[model samples]
Target: MLTIVKGPYLQWPTEDSMTIMWETSEQASSRADVLMAERIHSGYQGNYKKPEHVVSTVSNKGYCTIHQLTVKNLEPSTIYFYNIYSACEKGEIESGPHPLKTAVRKGEPFSFTVTSETGGYSGFDQSNGRINRNIFHQMQRYRPDLTLFVGDLVNDGQNYDDWEKYFFRPGKDFIINTPFYSCLGNHERNASWYYDFFAYDPPKNYYSFDYGDVHFICLDSTDFIKPEHYPNSAGEISSGNAQYDFLVQDLEATSAAWKIVFFHYPPYISGGYQVEELRKLSPVLEQYGVDVVFNSHTIVYERSHPIRGGQIDENDGIVYIVAGGAGAMPDWFLPKREWHTSQSLAVPHFVQVVVTSNLLELRAIDEEGRLFDALKIRKGTNGRKEFL
Candidate 1:
């Protein structure tokens, strides 16, 4: 039997609750066991082993199944090494000895990595081969607390084989230890494999997670608003009403020092696509006071100036980043006059976000370990602007 494919770890509402996901080739056993250890060492040796935690079987597809195990009563900001395995009468198929660190208690500082546009094949010369290896290598070097993928996990969303190959072989090591979050891209519109692969609390395409003093909101932009729906009119943001509603509630409910949103498409991009296409959802994002928005569809690295209500506003505007270069080839498009794009680069890269009590630093790093662009956003006071 093929080994279990682990991936797409999304944090739960609380730090104690965590959602784990994995896939198997054939049906071996119905029971799966999760073991946790505290204060693990580098070489995977320690006296940190929690009692075995049994998870309930939630759903299953033809050869894929999803199991959710919620671990409660965990210490804040602590490291927990865990393993998952199939329980059988004769023996078991073990996965792990992997380790994960819980979110900081509150008002603490942390760091994470954000990347997208990986695991795809546009053509022969533009394959995402190097991007995959580079990202995994960077993960090993950085060992970030969390990882977020904006979209395009696979070239074709319906191709289950690609998903298994891309994530299982290349991304398994990072997913097992660090909690990876994901959003749906245009490529995933026709595929249901994402839901089957990742076990989220709400069982929806979009969700929110809180770490340290920031709230990360993952959005599904493809189905939420389609270009076809608005023929004579511009595009309408109706792909995922459930997601928009959730966003409203999630943003209002959080009092974090920073608010960041990650999605597949750019609301304001200088790419080949039309500009008015993003007008539909611009209002909602502006109303909720989103600090930064990270997007990845164009396969190019571009950053826009602060934008609010579809206009560039430096003082109280959201910083938009297009980081589609995870593994996709760079697009050769220039910025339009209306975009007010501050900086643009066609390099394939990923972003490293470092969060502190007073400020948030975002660095766009390319595959060659070069910094393409850097931005420092300071925290505001009582909804007022605060600058460096």
Candidate 2:
């Protein structure tokens, strides 16, 4: 029997392109049939139109179990429905008629969800698998156009089973429709599987993308990992490294209205795990006008007061959010509140960020979809930000 072992999921979405990938039980060739649509669901399920031709990949060794296809020539900020088919020796297998929307143009409105530290073992008494399951369910309700995963998707990136049980199986329904971008976490162990499964632009580990008016960057934070765990992975985000150069060049080039960066280790946190070395990048982040930074590792929810030059500067400082409660074992806030902490809690939750030309709103919701915190920022003349 022919079977789809994994995926039928989305990735690396651009205004005019979206990549669809899947794994089959046998070596096979694949095809994607796409149809452009106006609305998300037009009360029409049975309608079908001739599809635009898709671009797919076949293994260099004739045929392979994995199938990947990039659907192109799409219209920006438009809706499209697609179906995937895989052909093997036995017969043809089909899935979808699924809906996906292309990236919205600059100054347009869009939303994305954020989650991190989702890769811990359930039995570790640190993180619960049930919470991961519930959080994913809640994430789908928001219908985010994109998902920004801070890091640690599996307990052991080298262990294949961990990927399926800890990450994929729990996130299947949510991931299929929502394309996500992730950074590397310590728990990933710098394994080969991490690189093989995802697609990115050059220097894959640290990359950036744009949606609407927001410029989103995901950095590897390689300094956090021990040498033995990542023997051959030498990428670093320090001031003198290549990753640093990319950050400078990319930040200087983009003209997006809002800038957000994320990674696994925190430069500033209310907890004990803060990486003092990472403080060196703060100047660069501030210089480039990064609005917010998301970090994970410690399992706690923390949003620091906007800080500039090591002090709270509400008028112009960048906000740092530690959204580490996705599915990791909980970590406690320090015995004494830190000067930078605006709000700190140890709860499993996810954040939804809605961005527009002049405004951005963020809401943090727990597993049950109850909002715990909300923030709104309005931009005025001269790119000045007023936080409400």
Best candidate, lDDT: 2
Q: Name the lDDT of candidate 1.
A: 0.67
Candidate 2 achieves a global lDDT of: 0.79
In model 1, what is the error at residue 343, expressed in angstroms?
Answer: 1.6
Using Cα atoms with residue i matched to residue i, what is each candidate's TM-score against the true structure? 0.84, 0.90
What TM-score quantifies how close candidate 1 is to the native fold?
0.84
Off by over 4 Å in 1: 5-13, 30-65, 89-91, 121-128, 230-242, 335-339, 386-388
Q: Please identify model 2 stretches exceeding 4 Å from their true place.
A: 37-42, 45-62, 121-128, 223-238, 328-331
- Poorest 10 consecutive residues of model 2 by lDDT? 53-62
- State the displacement of the C-alpha of residue 226, model 2, in Å, after optimal TM-score superposition: 4.1
Tens-digit lDDT string for candidate 2 (141-250): 99999998888888888998887887778888888888888888887877887787787775678889888899988888754345563322333545567788888999
lDDT of 1 by residue, 1-388 (tens): 4455444243452566555555554454433333454444443444554434533223222333455555556667866655555543344466655566777866777888888766643442244476676766676567777888888887777987777656556766676667778888777664788777665545457878778888888877765656466212232354456666787788879877788998776766676443355556667777777888888777777788888876778778888887776664444465353455888777667888888866888888887778878988876676654533
Clashing pairs in 2: 126-329
